[model samples]
Target: MTDTATTAASAVADATNLVPSTKAVRLPGAGKLLLAQIRYQVRLLISSGRAIAVGAGLPVILLVASKGKDTRPDVAGYAVFGLTITAWSTYGVRLVAAREDGVLKRWRATPLPRWCYFLGRILATALVAVLAGAVTVAAALVFYGSHFGDGPDTQLTVTAALAIVAVLLVGAFAWAATATALTSAIPTVEAAFPTLIFIYFPVIIVSGVLFTNLSEPHWLSTLATYLPAQPLIDAVTHAVRHTSGAPFLPVRDVIVLACWAAGGLLGAIVLFRWEPHRSTQRRAARIQQ
Candidate 1:
């Protein structure tokens, strides 16, 4: 009986040794994860025909319509318009829709860090916005015969180029953050479009995006001076005109943009939500109705 028991124990030990041991599952590094997320977000943007059409194509068409126009104020305004749409459509409406659709909630349950996801979204938006701005500017230069400076003889200095690039990047990120932050106020995906348009159209009008804001009332122009779009347009105008020197940087505009960027980021952090405000039943009932 003792020999039989010993043999059984030996057989069990041999069987255990023959089985494969499980190895620990390793996750991708944070940097890799962030890069992957950014790529995915950019793909999502590119795949959306409406996003490309409204964000990129519209501004180019507007620029083409105003052929032979000056580069400084006119092209600058159109370029900024492209940036605004890029940021708003990419982050604002998209995020609100994602949250209402439970995509954000599902993301929350994933192994990906929340910060990584948000950062990736912001970066992707900024990148696309900057590209849109660049395309508008390039189109102006190529087809419109517009030069960077006030005159054809005025060559673009390294410093001025740097300033323009810096402003484009900063402005893109600022607008993106502002758009995403505004998503907090948007309760439903259905309300996102008209609500954003209602708010944005007025600001752009006052900011002189459509026509020159110069013709507007003093109070309206002053209010727009403190707003986001005007500053961006002002900065771009200055840079495009190659008005370089100590005061080349539009200090007031930059400050206002920086303030808006800071405020928007803070608001986003404070008001962010992972789940939909409306319940599933309510959404279904609304759908049925």
Candidate 2:
């Protein structure tokens, strides 16, 4: 009986040895994950042909075709326009599409933190916007002889240059954050372009983005001055059109933009969703039950 028990024990041990042992797979740290996500998002944004064409190509073409003797304001306006296209329209559309396609849903299931994913996307959009805006500015300077200032008396100092760079950086992130928050309103990828265009074109026209609206009603012009685009354009215009040693920061415009950014960040935190619209609706229904 003892020999039989020993043989049974040996058989059990052999069976255990035949089975493969499981290894503990170590997950990457959050910092590494965030860096990887940011790099991936940057590559995705840079490869988007539509974003490039609309945000960079069209503006550069307009700059080339412009016949104005003073192209400084035009350069600034177009640079802002490029930024809006990249940071707002393109970014918003991509977010909505990702949610609709379940990409965001899948990402939410991963061990990766939600904020890291969003921050990566926002940073990538801002970087792309800056690149597109810079291309527009450079094209104007190289092709149109557009200077930062209106005349020789106006010059770009180191401080003023830094201010301009800061404005671009801030505006890019602001627009991107605003776009992310606004994506909650978009139900489908198909609706993104129409919705964004309806919001964008009218604002640009009223805000004097494409041209200086001199003949417009006084009230309309005043209203436009308060919109987001106008403030950005105004800030850029001030930076480019002012004399040497002039204040580059437009305090009122900066305040308005800051309000928008704060509102956008708040909205994104409150309303952002990871699931597709249909799934979200079903979840809501279940909760109501």
Candidate 3:
């Protein structure tokens, strides 16, 4: 080749070198992406009428409904945070919807990390749950004149409240993780809704907080001991009663709930997939064609 040709070729190569990378150069961290997701989720939570009722309204109503009697804060906790679990379970459904709608698929094509996506959901849900819990607590204190423990035991009551809040917060993250795993396996949002109902309502009904005494020795009551919700409630209740000088250890209950949380998070990380299920349908249809 001539010297001119060589020079032209070299210029072309250098220009190509400067043509910018197609491999998606990632900046520092996924923190901004995760924060954006959390903000969007918070807006979604606040805008939904159902979410308002479930995340905030229900807690206050349940607290006021107790009507100045022998009020169990655990019952209030259940009403407030139980629906929080249900709401976060809907996070799983959102995953299904997003996948089916191609939102997750598009996101997967980006440089934003996977953990940030799910972490945003968990953090957002936890925030809403904590808000609901705060409302319930305020209603208990102001509306019903409820007390965690009698006078001269203020410090113990505060300790119990903190412990219960901590349990609920951890449980929220667990519910978010577990529900993500469950809904990810499901192909459609419609199916996911029913699955959530089947998973949530049965556990709520059988927790024995609604009907039977947890102290009862029946097999169903015994079975409740194995579930996460019941154990959390038990732990909080023990904390409350312990404030009144009762000797109680919530180790068994806290351990059970913590195990559930950890197992759920690990399961979600392993089992949840962002890929759309429609790929199989498309391939099958093409084969038929």
Candidate 4:
């Protein structure tokens, strides 16, 4: 009896030791999350032909329209700049609309890290923007005889890197802030672009896309420089022109973009709603009906 009892106790101890420890599962790292988000956004873009057409088509149309007989370098630069700006703006607006449509909201509710969600959208946008920018540059070079300086490969590389970074920052912030502010007011994905246009058109005009130069008052130019598109335009123009000087580091453009991004992030945090307005409205109408 004593031996049997001892055996049973040992068996129980062995069983307890055999049971797996309750180690907490670790969440993905920031890098992994970012990659996942990028993949997801890319997949979404591929799936939606309409989105791709709009995103890619507008740039192509502008390029075709701006392509002139002379093929001047300045013309090429401006054309690329305009196309890139449009791509960035379009992507930003679409991103917000998709998020407000509940895709991002659903992902946010999951166990996935928030950084992954945000980074994914950003990465996807960056990829599209870079590709679009490259195509725009190539088209300008081929059709307009546009050319960049043969400065050591290093300079070209650095300039390109800076340009992409600036675009991503500006684009992300514009999309986030515009989306949040409009969503707060309209609370529907359908209304996102129309609401954003009120802000977008003014920036486009002040950025001198239409004018030969920012011939506005000094204060207007200064203020416009701080707006999203102008800073990006200034950065692209300086880089393309290879204007080496104290004021042309592209840092000012980057700072303005950072401020926009920060402001948008804050607004999104404060006002983003997960529930669809249509659904809510439908339920209310049903209750009344």
Cα lDDT computed for each candidate against the true fold: 0.78, 0.80, 0.67, 0.58
Candidate 4 segments exceeding 4 Å error: 1-23, 46-52, 69-89, 92-101, 146-181, 213-218, 243-248, 284-289
For each of the candidates, give the backbone clash count. 0, 0, 0, 3
TM-score of each: 0.81, 0.81, 0.77, 0.71
Estimate, for each residue in 1-289, the C-alpha lDDT of model 4 and write its tens digit.
6999999989988786766678987766777777767788777765765444654455556667755534333332343344434344455566556655776678778988765676466556556555555555555556545344223321333555466445644654454454444455566556666766666666667777444463578887778777766776666666655545544336877788778767866775666555666667888999998
TM-score of 3: 0.77
Rank by lDDT, descending?
2, 1, 3, 4
Candidate 2 structure quality by residue, lDDT tens digits, 1-289: 5999999989988786765568877778889988899899989987766777778997897776774655554777888899888888888889999999999999999999888898888877887887888788777668646444356644544665567667876777877887788788889999987888788788889988888878999999998877778888888777766664557789998887777777777788788878889787889899999
Residue-level lDDT for 206 in candidate 4: 71
- Candidate 2 residue-pair clash tally: 0
Pairs of residues clashing in candidate 1: none
Clashing pairs in 4: 37-120, 38-120, 71-144
Model 3, 160-195: lDDT tens digits are 777767777776666777777777778877887788
Higher-scoring candidate on lDDT, 1 or 4:
1
Top candidate, metric lDDT: 2
**Model 2 regions more than 4 Å off:** 1-32, 68-73, 146-150, 154-158, 242-245, 280-289
Stretches of model 3 off by over 4 angstroms after superposition: 1-26, 31-36, 68-74, 80-84, 146-157, 213-217, 242-249
lDDT of 1 by residue, 21-82 (tens): 68877877889999999899888887776666776688889867766564443777888888
C-alpha lDDT of candidate 1 relative to the true structure: 0.78
Model 3 per-residue lDDT at 41: 76
